[model samples]
Target chain A: MLDVIKSVLAAFFGVQSEANRQRDFQAASPWMFIVVGIALAAVFVLIVAGVAWLAAQ
Target chain B: MKRFALTGICFLLLAALMAGSTYAASINTSTGWNMPPGVTDVSREVYSLHMTIFWICVAISVVVFGAMFWSLFAYRKSKGAKSAHFHENTTVEVIWTAIPLVILIVMAVPATATLKKMYDTSNAEIDILVTGYQWRWRYEYLGEDVSFFSNMSTPRDQIQGLEEKGDNYLVEVDEPMVVPLGKKVRILLTANDVIHAWWVPDLAVKKDAIPGFINESWFLVNEPGIYRGQCAELCGRDHGFMPIEVKAVPQEEYDAWLASRRDAAVAEAAGADREWTMDELMERGAGVYNTYCAACHQPEGQGLPPVFPALAGVGMSVDPEQRAEHIAMVAYGKTGTAMPAFGDTLSPAEVASVITYERNAWGNDTGDMVQPSEIRDLLGK
Candidate 1:
């Protein structure tokens, strides 16, 4: 489970390799990657929001 | 190790930047890094659009690079971090692609609308025919007999470091293309000789002036001021010399100027037939030569040597027999050379005056008076 999260995090930074991709695909279920992807995207939006808020100040 | 060093260096730089300067430099000032939302609706829109994209890119870089640096610093080998190897899944790929799609959709909507408005040149109140020559511009107002060739008015002395340069140097012209404020002016662009692009960033109008083809663009002036631009293409040797100056004025003033311009044209036509004195011929010829010929032969009649023959006292035109040949050369520009034929371009009187000026001004005293009638005969008019 931790491996899935780390792999998804690396992919979020857009530096994932084919080997990591194959490992993630061969995992028991696909739900872990989806959940982590959404989580990372949400983090992205939140970072954008926080920076925008600070800039507005 | 490399990534660790990069993140460390980035943080150090950021720290130095934040701690170093209380005087934060601003972008996009009059002489700075930003576009002026000029005093026109279209230009304002362009500026807004440009700023929106600029900020968006800035925001993106900040977020992406911030997260990257954070991860790099936190996951360094020195920090006892071990590399984890895991790759992409189908669901994550789809979401990543879709997120970018959403952002693009948001941007494309307004961008398309602005582009469509810019392309629509319909229902303009005035039409100005802008023809680009080799290194000059000719503006002819449609449905008006007011037309003139605009040339670079900056003297060569300043350009060659012989005199002090003025504030508006190189950007000034003998005649400016005048238009009225709050009126949509459609510019029909074409080229007389080669391809040139008329570009004025403040007005947000740029179109190619291509030979044998017409391109169209339009702009409505919202304020009264002088806006300048240049031929934004490589046309010839003197491409940098040609500049476009647009003077926007109130409607009433524009009408008065138009009337005066028409009157001036009539007065010039009347004077064409008037018998001119040696002094008058010399003066008029100087003006004509400086406009057309001086670029090659030079202002002082001392041509640029072998390429452009010297017309000074001791040059070929000083000889009695070469006088007729000089007239023919000016009238029918020598082929296989850079000398442009002015027979079709210059009026009969203009050709006569210029020849008279050249022969007399430099004291190349053949004392030869070639009448306008003589030039007309050679032109077979």
Candidate 2:
């Protein structure tokens, strides 16, 4: 049972670790994720605000 | 474990905050969201159907998502969840499918009824032919001695965002469609060129006005109020400038309005027989031109490039014999071109006034005052 759990964890993290090892991964940069995340967050905020406003009306 | 727990708590807090804020905001404006006086049976039906569907969706989402989230938290891996291997349950599959089928049947019955109601525009009490031009609306009360053009009353400065927003803003119009309450109003909608949609959301009616084809819709107002809407179609450059205002008044008020409109039409026809001074023609002509012609021909009499031919120094403007042809073109329009037929859209006097303005403006110096009677004669031919 413990070995099965270890295998599953390894399967999940192994792919990520291999991808990170490649120098091509550096091309995307950390700021790209932050920028995209912020944009998505702003849109979510706006949608929530609009729904709230409509409900109040 | 601690990190995972913190992330879950944070997500829950964020969701709760967002939902709470939305709920609070909505409570403040509940009454303002009610449907306006529904003039037509179809509009009222549509409003009811909209509310019905909205609530149904809300119920469905709550039930489905509620179960989903409950399962997610209750059966999380951290809680030592065990996977159930009883995959093929025919009873469960049948029950789920049957339940969804029942829900769809309930929704479909009302939706179909509303659709059938929306399609019945026959045997209307009054018929009005509504034509959409580039940036204005023309209304003709069929079989009645009443027809007029309506244009944006808001000044150019306000449209360009130069002036502070006025009370009406883009909702202002020089003339509004006035209809009597408790009468079934049938609207025959079409466009002079391109496509436009006549929509009044409060009335719960929207019908596409396509060029070369007539579409019909009807509405009956139950109460008196000033209801405003905008051109819902993206027709062209000045689509946003076109707004629709309908005043539903008592039957007596509507009768008074109709009488005045008839009087104006009669007065305009009578004025055509007289010899008008150049000043009078120019004053009225300028106003007519700005409202009807300026959108495509431009305020300076310089037409839009490539599509609309320049009126300034054009052969049609200077030649005396070509004046009739010019008037005909403005009235009947050149087919397969951007120039829409103004005959159906403009009153005879409006056509005459615009022609007079075009002939004299941009130093054409034609000094001609085309009479509405002349236009009336041309229209007959």
- Candidate maximizing TM-score: 1
Relative to the real complex, the DockQ score for model 1 comes to 0.10
lDDT of 1 at B100: 74
Each predicted complex: what DockQ?
0.10, 0.01
lDDT of 1 by residue, B125-240 (tens): 99999999867898999998888889999988889999999888998999999999999999999997789999887898878999999999999998999998899989887899
Kindly list the interface RMSD, in angstroms, of each predicted candidate in the order they appear: 7.7, 16.9
lDDT per residue for candidate 2 within B270-333, as digits (tens), equals 7656666667767888888888778888887888878877787776867888987898799988
TM-score of chain A of 1: 0.76
Worst 10 residues of 2 chain B by lDDT: B28-37
Off by over 4 Å in 2: A1-57, B1-45, B82-88, B313-315, B318-325, B343-345, B362-381
